[model samples]
Target chain A: MMEQSKEPLLEVRDLRVDFRVPGGYATAIRGVDLTVGRGEVVGLVGESGSGKSISMMALLRLLPAAARVSGIARFDGVDLLSLSPRELSHIRGGRIGMIFQDPLTAFNPVLTIGAQIVEALQLHDRNLSGKAAWTRAVELLAEVAIPEPGRRVHQYPHEFSGGMRQRAMIAMAISNRPQLLIADEPTTALDVTVQAQILELLQRLREELNIGMIMITHDLGVVAGIADRVMVMYSGRVIERGQVDDVFYASRHPYTRGLLAALPKLDGAREALVGIAGTPPSLINRPAGCAFRPRCSHAEAVCATAEPPLLRAGQLESACYVSDRLSGMTP
Target chain B: MLRYIFRRLIAVPLLLLGVATVAFFLSQTTRGDPLSAVVPERQMNNPEIVAAAKERWGLDKTLAERYVIYVSNLARGDLGTSFTTRRPVSADLAERLPATFELVLAAMTFATVVGVGLGVLSARYQNGPIDHFSRIFALLGSSLPVFWSGLILLYLLTVQLGWFPGPGRLSAHTPPPPPITGLYTLDSLLTGNIPVFLESLHRLMLPAIVLGWSVVGVITRLVRSSLLEVLGQDYIRTARAKGALEGRVMIHHALRNALIPTLTIIGFAFAYLITGAVLTEAVFSWPGIGSYAVSAARALDYPAIIGVTLLGSLAFLLANLATDIAYGLVNPKVKLQ
Candidate 1:
């Protein structure tokens, strides 16, 4: 399912973000390199505070003013970071769209769903008339499978249920036919059944539009179902990344293996789940060595000396020095 | 929405009745006889004159009978007779209400516009020079007594600079315009008397500003804090993510939400200003209801006092109703039904 030969839609290199704090600057995204090809869905999986969302937000310059971002984010041959605010705004919700985790909060409560969608449409296309935008907004809602698009269009966000609001949010996001869509935990706030439906809707939309997507979530199940490639982050850095099948089945990093081990199996007899010991390290004052060293059972003396770089092998990349020696062991 | 308004309207009379009962009893408890103001001093010893005066004003009846009579008269739209003015309280109020309305409306409009504008600017430029200046302005406006500010402004603008006309709604040389709405500015405008209109507006400036200053202070702080909170909302971020420029984001998304709370404050402030601009009215000699209320209190005019209190309560109730209706209109989540 991996499409390495396809031209990349978004290429980000050495993306770093530091937020101003009371004492000093805290490193949020230490260094992240990401690539999403056209018509592909790349899963960015990590625990909370792992910089999964911050890295994507930084590319769009959507972070708070206190955050200092330094990176090269090129989307469709345009260096996003270098673009002026005027130029960058054209790209935001125009060439690139974003969906937040909580749709209820993401939407303006006072504005009707249709008006919000029309706003997004008119922001990119100045010539779009209010009537035309309203018509298009209705069509977009119907396209997202919202019931009675005409009536739902006039309804407010609070009137919509969690699942329906997410659908409307997606409708607004894709109102301008964006080339790339960044869904930040789109289904995390939804119910299990609704999550499946939203995932299906996203998959269908991605295929029909041939849009590049970055799916940010902590749910492994979501990534396994829809993602072509996967990147696992820990403490503001990507520890492992590869094709979804390769990374899931033959996971190399100790943290990745621990994550796989933690997943509950439906086929096997009931058993207590194996959780990774200790929490992710704090980004403010991280230990000098590997962030996952204290939690890793296979930690060695060298692991305490320096953090290992991404050691790529074939279709997989893992930031672990002893992964080669542990290849034969099952998670 | 109509049903909601109707329901609110239904409660108005009952609420007014409560206000009337409270005002009537409170005024009745005061240590003064209504006849004292109505009859001459020598008549205090004259039994015939005293009895005639008590009988004419219905003061000869028992307290219960008097209350029943007062309530029955209130039901018939008579506010009884004022001891000081010797005219029906209702007639006195009718003549004075418009003047107070014009003054309070002008003050409220000024307060809302300037207060909300300054608030938005201050919040947009948080921690900047404008923010600091507005913060101090609000602090000073709230802390300074209206009478002190009114006097100071009167001395500076009228006595020192002679930039504006000294008191009253119109100049001493100008005759009153035809009383259409009983508001000089509006009445003059209706009659196409530009000079009277301009003169009335000029005379109105200092009093309105002094009366509105404290309300402006309240509304500014409310809007500033509210907008600051709204600016941090997820929907505001969503608005920005949609490529909305800063101006659009602030006005379209942030301001509307911020103004919801501010709207409630503004409505109550307007109600308060109507009867509370006593010092401003006295200083400027605008001949509004605030001064009427003060003189009524000084003479212990029960009918006039109760009538003013009833008007104040009615304003408060109506303001509350308006705020609720506005809330329902602005926030769809609030079910008007």
Candidate 2:
């Protein structure tokens, strides 16, 4: 058997997403550059308030009614922003699948899992008959390792256990077998064991299906386990980008360091885990200069003077003005 | 489901008892007495005649005793004699109910077909010109007085245009069909008299339309709003995502759930059709309960007034109860709750 070569399946470049606030417009995603090659997993890590989810939503043009997206979100050389509602609808579930965060709240409560999955299949492939659609739906459910797939397929979303519902969501997402799968906090609401199993299932599926993925999560541990590359976002801007190991072991950005330090090590080296102090800046009225400058301990006058742009730091991109200083090199 | 029925069954008798008690006292308390209408012109000022009338009708007894007698008579389907008509109240209701029912059925058919169709179409094409127009139409339909509308229709369609008959259930020249049932439409149909049936339809059409216009308006708005809300739900999005066609998603997924609220409105509208729109009945002089009740009031026929009022109230309550059961059946979530 010949080895398949890796190539970019999805690319988002210089993307900006803005929303009109009370008296002014607030940028939800500012000049984010990201890529997910075929058979690769890239995690988008940020806190609750960060625009990681917004960026993903923008890539799919799935933002709320108020959002205004610009720049390029290219999946297979086709710009998403330029597509009409009809064209976009074609790609949404047909080509690029999305799994929402909360499984319990994701699926329509009234519809049976089989019905939802079959609807997705029938939507894209009109040639597939009803019997064929149901058969394929059952196959997809079984592929997701749903025990008693035949019986469970007839059950509504609420009938299933939480983990089972999440699996059903995955089944629905992948029923069409799209080129790229966007899993947004797919296991955030589950127990630890279920989370591990789901992540494992996702990771295994990525390899087996060779479909690209953009996994968005707040936990760095999730990125470490599944992501080949990781991007760190803060206040609607990408702060750091690199290979997972480069970003994790040798983080050169101050915010990245603060985030890494905050992670509770599984080895229990510390009796109590430390957390990053101070709250995330509000998008409605952001402060001048670097958004993170107020929270940085090594802040100098220059740090607060102007907003630092995301620039290349060795092999990775770092937005800090003092990336060298954070890396222990004098400017 | 059985639990709901059991609850309603227990409530019916209690409600009927309350209605009976209120009717007995309200009649007693009212200024004019039933004997005032029953006594002949020659005996207008005779106390002996008034006392005889009261005793014959059993109205001279204490209120509680009158209620017991009323309840017992109602159990045996005896609604007492109509004080003004000198006919049995039950006979009057039996003669009149079928006519009203026919008119009501016609109105309901018109309302359901037009209102629900317009509503679904409006919601399906929300904010479009059709939706806007339907909304405006519903507003106008709801706001117009039924009696005024009926009068205008009579003038335009019957009096001037000569497109329909102005009033009554049949043409005077037609030998009144053998009166099997008082409802001319049914009797005409049973004897296979096409012209008579068609003529009866023509006479009833304007009144039904006038009465049903508000119902159509209400049902349309109810269906449109309910469908719109259902269309915007996440499951609808999920259905769309599943690649279900827009029509399928709407009809199969959104519409059925939306009908829960709509069914309630439908029940209320049906009840209104049965009891509301008194003005339209009077305008056309169709001899339905609306007109009957009015004449009964003017002539101080207490028994007839009480019977009509109780019947109307019963229809309203039963319609709502049926709506609840329907709502439960349509959505299992509602049933569980």
Candidate 3:
């Protein structure tokens, strides 16, 4: 799996998203590049306003009226952005399934879970009968490990608990057996126990279904176990990327280092977590140089004037010049 | 659900009592003494005759005493006699209410079909030519006065072009079709009286359009905004992400949810069309209860005014209840709450 897999299943290049706000255009996604090989798991890690979700949404052309997305998102050699909505409809839930955050509000309250699943199944395949769709929906629910799939499918979204609702959403997303499954903050709304369960369910589904996935989350702990590769994003740009273990053990960017330092360490002697000082820069009025320079502890004279592009360090990619300088410093 | 409805039902009588009390007091406060409306001005100066007329009609009683008498009569299902007509207000209401309902129902149909269609279209093509047209159209429709529209339409279409009859529920020659539903159009259709149905529709057209025009604006704007908002919901995006056809996404997902607020607007709009079409009815001379209420108001017929208001309040309440049930039906979360 670590071999340089050529011709990835999904490839995103130089994706940029801008929204028309009151004063002027606010750039949400500056420039992002991502690729997912067949049956591979790529975790996209970022803060709330880091454009992780927006960039993924732009892949399927799912942004709203006010948003303007410009990019090349190629799924199976087809450019998604070039396709019309009518043409894109074939690939949206058919080839690329998306599971959203907040499972409680994701599913339509009025529609039965079975109905929603069946509708998704039948949308792409007109030949599928209602009965067949219903049966398949139950099977999908069972595949997601939802209990009493037969009876529970008939109930509305509110009838299910948070974890069950998220599982039901997974069932709906995977009902069509999409080649690329994009789960956006899938377990963010659940309790710790339920979050683990949901993550396990997602992992199990990935193995059984063998579908390529792009997992978006802010929690580094979530990415540690599941992700094959991790992409660290800051101010709408990919700051660093590499194998998950390599990036986690040898973080290159200052922002990634700050993020890792802030997380509570559970192993060995406990150390005080180093808090990252500044908040994420506003997209409307981002600083000219490196977006994280204000918060970077080792920021020098050169860090403020010119932005540094992603550069190869030892194992992971680095977007800051001070990576070697930080590594040499004594604790 | 039954308990909920039963609780709402219990409030009905209490509400009716409040309405009746308000109507009674309002009639007393208004100008045009009932005696003066009934008797000629030449006979008004004669104090002896005025005293006799007051005694006969019980206008000599205090407001509280009159109210007690009105309530007692209402308990027995008797609406006291009209000051001008010398007939029970109940009989007049029964005769007049059907016309208002017919006109209002027709207007509601027109409003709903036009409004919902325009709304969905506007939302689908947001900021397009159709959206611009609908925005301007709704603005004009809502801003234009009902009586003004009614009069202009009546004058232009009826008096000038002669496309429809000027006024009245039916022509002078045609008697109302056999009273099956009390609605002439429905009764005519049921009885297979095409001529009567056509005539009734012809007379109803101008007034219905005028009354419904403003309501159409309300429903259209409500639906447009509601649909735009609902289309932006997570569920709607999910539906689209499911590769569902745009039409299915718009109607099945967005429209049904959007129609929740529009449904409430439609129900109250229907009630308002019936009860508040006083000027439209007058302008077109369509003899619905709206006209009856106006005449009652003009003639200072206290019992008649109170009866009309009481009936309007009842219809409005029922419409509101129906709307709530519909809201629950469209979105299950509401019923659960």
Candidate 4:
């Protein structure tokens, strides 16, 4: 059933991603559904093996050839999967931009930053002259607060430090004023200070440009700072979804609770941090029913026998049968 | 750059010394003799003529004495006299060197332009019909024996097709250009003789093509693989995500990164052009060093053999040196290290 309300800017429904292995097929992402309104920042939080990156890559149809993805990913009411490669390519950078995690490996070291940025502009607008294109590039670099934009424009990616490279990457991503920006763990590799600065820049750009974004991360702190709404994923499926405050303060899913409990407190308290037990299930041979039932403290016979659907739990929606376990309503 | 050249200059003489030592011993110990090839069997049977020949050529001295004289001559830029022509060996190589240089230069120019262009097109439309066609053509060039290909081209063009002449540098009827730099093309161009220049260029074209075709396959594969590797890097994806045209990504973002490895392949290929294409030159009778070296080895002309061997070794050394310098230029990591 569809929601009888204002249409969202991007809507993904019942998405399934499976891969062919040597023995048989293995499903990595199983029926994940989420949406983002225009100008909203949606955080996709999960541990390393939770398929957060794959789901984001799936939206762009950018996964490997072996990946078999099915379901609807509608962007501006256009089915992204249904478009031809040519149309998809035109949309890939012009409409929906992506910023990868590693800044060091994210740029071609030999080319000048100006040439790289100008090329991005020229791809869509063939009528622009080289001088105009270069001027636009310098302007974009300046927007990103890069010092001496004109002088730094001619410098190669290797000439800049890590933080500068990240900024240059940001300049390239937002140059075309894309509608949707996906930043996948963009600050995980940088130091704490640089990470905070990049997050701040991203939040500022999101507001100024009024663009929708899907920020993928395993850290709850990142989600806490910038996310308007949050989707907690476990083994490629959406386990919880709601407003960021409701999801963070009133988390119903055990995985979400575990992720929150695992976070180290910033306050100067000497309490021991509780770590999540059990390794993530391997994609090659996953368990039946609820994937996280074995690790859930409140799991029962019903939890292991039948997979729970994404149903209502207080203010948030979660895919856990024992959602009321912590509330003492069920035993 | 200075340090790189210094390292290369030091390495060159050591490489030459190793090559000279090998060439000298190999020439001495090989099946045939310079005496038999030059003196004739009848003249060699006469002891007085043989002794006189040995003394005059310094063959009567100990091996150590000959080596000392050999190194001293090398130091003085003297390559010694030829056993067959009874002329200074340097003069013979010098006469042939320009022709070889001219031919190699033409071949390299043709190969780089055609091969790299084809590679870019193929990679851009990868696995498409054009890519398939290009890959097949490149494979044919790569797998075909160069000597056989040369003969086939000769037969098809000269005998069957009747589109071109066979087995010569230029037309026999025309007067040879005034030896300005010993390269016919340059001399004719310098003298402003269009007809002579055209004639020389036309003849050079086929030999160059035959040699260059093999190089085309090598460089195309090199560029294709290198481009493919570079294309998969995060920077290329970032470039694409930034709305850079696919063409721009291929050329500006991908190709520069690709050139690093491709350059090393090209340098070695050029060095190989000198020694390995002997059959192609022999088939076409292009009068390059390849053909001359083959005969020099057969006749056991010690000086000619030594000179050609040393030059070939020097070519390899210089090629490697050039590759290192190019590597430093292309890769920031290399320069930093």
On DockQ, the leading prediction is 1
Tell me, by lDDT, which candidate is best.
Answer: 1
Pairwise TM-score winner, candidates 2 and 4: 4
- Give the 10-residue window scoring lowest on summed lDDT in candidate 1 chain B: B26-35
Per-model DockQ: 0.75, 0.33, 0.70, 0.51
Poorest stretch of ten by lDDT in candidate 1 chain A: A1-10
The clash number for model 1 is 0
lDDT of 2 at A20: 82
Error (Å) of candidate 2 at residue A302 is: 2.8
Interface RMSD of 1: 0.8
Clashes of 3: 0
Q: Is the docking of candidate 2 incorrect, acceptable, medium or high quality?
A: acceptable
- For model 3, state the Cα shift of residue A120 in Å: 0.9
Fraction of native contacts under 8 Å reproduced by each candidate: 0.64, 0.25, 0.72, 0.62
lDDT tens digits by residue: candidate 4, B164-222: 77677787898879999988999999999889898888888878888888888888888
lDDT per residue as tens, model 2, A97-210: 888887766776666788888888877887999999998888998998999888988877878888888888888888878878888898899988999989998988888888
Q: Is the docking of candidate 4 incorrect, acceptable, medium or high quality?
A: medium
Candidate 2 iRMSD, 1 decimal: 2.8
Candidate 4 Cα outliers beyond 4 Å, as residue runs: A1-7, A20-25, A271-273, A328-331, B2-18, B29-32, B109-140, B186-192, B215-217, B245-247
Tell the DockQ for candidate 2: 0.33
Q: How would you encode candidate 1's per-residue C-alpha lDDT over A1-331 as one tens digit per residue?
A: 2453465899999999999999999999988999998889999999899999999989988888999999899898889999988898898899899999999999998899999999999999999999999999999999999999999999999899999999999999988999999999999999999999999999999989988899999989999999999999999999999999988888888898888888888897799887888988888889878888988889888888998898895458999888887677766
- After superposing candidate 2 on the true structure, give the runs of residues whose Cα lies further than 4 Å from its correct spot: A1-7, A21-24, A269-273, A328-331, B1-7, B105-135, B153-165, B168-205, B216-232, B243-253
lDDT value, residue A114 of candidate 3: 93
Q: By descending lDDT, how would the candidates be arranged? A: 1, 3, 4, 2
Between candidates 1 and 3, name the one with more favorable lDDT.
1
Candidate 4 chain A, run of 10 with poorest lDDT = A322-331
